[model samples]
Target chain A: MGIVATSFRDELLAAGLLVPLGADGLYGRAAAFEDVVDALARLIVSLGAADGAARIRFPPIEPRSVFDRTDYLRSFPDLTGAVVTFRGDDAGHARLLAAADTGDDWTELLEPADAMLCPAVCHPLYPTLTGTLPAGGATYDLQGWCFRHEPSVDPARMQAFRQHEIVYVGDAAGARAHRDRWVERGTELLADLGLDVEAVVANDPFFGRVGRMLATNQRDQELKIELVVTVASADQPTAVVSSNCHEDHFGAAFGINTAEGDVAHSACVGFGLERVTLALLRRHGLDVERWPSTVRDRLWP
Target chain B: MTDDVIRAVLAEHGRLAVDVAALDPDADLYQVGLTSHASVNVMLALEDSFDFEFPEQMLRKRTFESIAAIRAVVDGLTRAEVD
Candidate 1:
């Protein structure tokens, strides 16, 4: 159904980068796509440093208490996926197993919510704010394993993926500068990969009533932009990466007082490593050696 | 303990910074410019430089935030093995 589907998978694997994650025989649009995933990600952090963004890596998971503050759930409710464990009596476990065997989901039998579920596209800057700041504004590049509860049949859009975020948590001007630079630079870099991509001003998909207000506000502020390409189909271009300027949302929520005791705002450029790799593979044939000389030299070498 | 080792290792990675030693033992890794991806890069560099395997448990937060923290973990992991 897609470029990474069984039909075109081997074509991509011939590039020598696509490694199989499952036996679907779906030729996953990219070779060692996971390595490409990592390579592009490393490129992301390196870009952050080049743009003068401080680099930081958070735990793959975030504290639920903090995730609630950002209201990430309110916006990405559909993209929301979680990891939860079931604890119950042995009889209950046996019942659940039997139910599962019978093709009946026994999830309703146990507590739905208990420990921390994965944060949907959320990075933890709160823990990083130990009440200090540089004389100037600060920019940070954050990366972690992010999960989405919803699964897509498209290999490019996996249920679980990695995100490299370069955030500017400081003054509004600094935040804008940081986000703007990456939005432009990232598009150019993608172009270098020999892909035709565009940067579109976008917004977060907020959940309910409060979400409506936030989503609209996000759109108005032009705070988020996605690097989109026609992968699934030319008519329906999909977003591969995002660059966002989150103003003071993180600063106010995290009590991240600056050196002068002012809460510093924040912005970030997020790279969907898998999607980018998928885009690159779809752009060029899967053969690693045949990729653009520049991209090829950088990656394979 | 010297720049040559770190620099030589970093030279292998065209993009990643090689000044990992600049990081303090407890300084927040992000604060010292160590993004998670870069953390992996540095780890890879260490692996290549020392030519050994690091214990998986050491990959946790207790030892990754600072170079001193990483060195201690790597040094411990490397030293405890048969050379």
Candidate 2:
């Protein structure tokens, strides 16, 4: 098997921006890459600063109990990741070691962990937000590491990534307004950074037979929209930012209520840090210093 | 007959808190406690009972909004089968 260096991912690896692990979708970031990601995160915060969104951060893995309440497993079982750990005794451990020595399937010996990798940044916050809200509702500035099990060589799609999200939980009108505003703002922000960007109606990759209907329904209602940019190819653009209106889905799931005694509607705008960085690199070049003056000033200045 | 089957399917798979039989044909199922997650179950069950697959065009929320909507869609698909 010969690995070619013609791909964008290969170029990143060659330029020392991304350090590849043994896996297809997993990688370590070099200092230069980390700096770009950090700058992007800061830019996101600055853009949303006027909104007064309360900042919150959580670890990548959330409790399985909370994960069970979400519809992720039902809709996206293909992308869901469940944490498992070894809980075996001495005999079991010895067997596991023996299997490891012989290169057998030792993962079967592991037990289900109490945690699962969070698929979205806003998911874990819903549990804390159960109960009624105040007058105008709440807005949160959240950033976290999110996980999905989709392994691909696209480099844009990673198993592990960071999301900087602005989440609003309130009435239906407020939620939709939040999503709509963000759709415009997010597109402008990305476009200003020197990328060819567009906001388009999009749907989640819902799973299975019934999921097809759900995807169509979602698109019909315009519940989700994404700001996409060409990262890998001209034909296929990646979603660098997305605005979604959950429309009481999370409120119903987590029992969150509004000031008006109705189930609260939730919306979020998530910016993919790594994807945007990659988009910038693809648009400009791997050398950050050599980037267009406008782009450099927007990020570093 | 189609309405009865839709009702029975709703009773079994809708997981709704309300009684499906008592609701009006135009009632919004989602407002009556039917969730998006449960709606998938309802959609699959409806497919099983009708023995017809829903094309992408007919898979909107309006198709499953009420008993009448479900009945209409089912009738159209099965009638197409007869044709």
Candidate 3:
């Protein structure tokens, strides 16, 4: 007897919904798979169209200098990925080739590139929004590929994924309201798409001992909240959406001030595009055509 | 005393907007603009100055909320080291 696909990841691969590319947490999506993702992206844009957010699409990587200025490295050094390239002379290239020929680690020859793989879709936007805001501050509608170094076998936990985010920069009260409203809206949106969704307090995967305190502080302060759905199993659910209040962190770092002269406060609601698509697949089955009429209409219309 | 050492460490690394010496011991470090990023540096410096590593349980924000709080933790760790 052959092996039965028990895990959602295995089922996804077996159904040709996901194509393995010889790496954990990395895969190529089938056209149908990509179609679902596209539909979800469009749905998010349509939902937020009334807000008049300035739409911006960013490259997958951001400047290392800008990235270093942020606290991402201090908090999540383990999960941050930076781009490295060969910036050496011919002699160094020859040595690299020799090392590669012998199956030795040749990556030591590569130097740090000017960029780091963007960990969040909103990360690159802060630097551009420096200086004081005009009137009610700014809001942005953004979508971009984000990279994290967490390689996992869970299909929903892709290392490279697309994020659709609506970010607002304004006063502290406005920031909290933005995050709170999204927590409600995101949960409702996912539930409308035919997924059993729940909102819960969450924390980032901070690094080291000091990070524990940071994580605790973040949770205590209710800085982050995630919209979770059971994609794989009831025991292990995935966060498909996250609403975060940065609360002057980015304002202080980027020197963005409010119109009233105090430091600006910021918040963002992010949708994990791939994870939401995966949850739909897991809940409704691999075939999008056979999904419930209500779900199909919500996604397609 | 640990109080003076804590004061000096805060002056050098707390990155607070206020003068460390003039600030009250019970005043909130965060209220004075000691960011989480700066707090990590202060934690490291405290570890170095006292020659004792803080246990994981003592790594909460409360452990470093104020000069008095930091002094209490430092004294506890040093006393444990001595015992």
Docking class of 2: acceptable
Which whole-number lDDT from 0 to 100 does residue A271 have in model 3?
Answer: 97
lDDT per residue as tens, model 2, A1-301: 0122138889999999988898988999999899889999998888777677888898898999889887788889999888999997999999999999999999988999999999998888999999999878899999999999998888888999999999999999999999999988888888889998888999999987668877877887789999999888767788999999987788888999999998999999999999999999999999988999988898888
Query: For model 1, what is the alpha-carbon lDDT of residue A72?
Result: 64
Off by over 4 Å in 2: A1-6, B8-35, B47-58, B76-83
The most accurate candidate by TM-score is 3
lDDT by residue (tens digit), candidate 3, A115-170: 99999998889999899898888889999999999888777778999999999998
Checking candidate 2 for backbone clashes, the offending pairs are none
| Poorest stretch of ten by lDDT in candidate 2 chain B | B30-39
lDDT for each residue of candidate 1 in A1-301, tens digit (9 for 90 to 100): 5643534445444545655566442333343567677778777767778868666666666666666776566467776544466778999899989998998977766663433445533456665674767766676777776766555445565656678777766676777888888888888878877779988988665555435445554665577889998565565576888888776667766777666776676777888777787777777756545777888756645
Compute the DockQ of candidate 2.
0.48
Per-residue error at A21 for model 1, in Å? 6.9
Q: For all candidates, state DockQ relative to the true structure.
A: 0.01, 0.48, 0.57
Q: Provide candidate 3's TM-score on chain A.
A: 0.97
| Reference-based TM-score of each model | 0.67, 0.91, 0.93
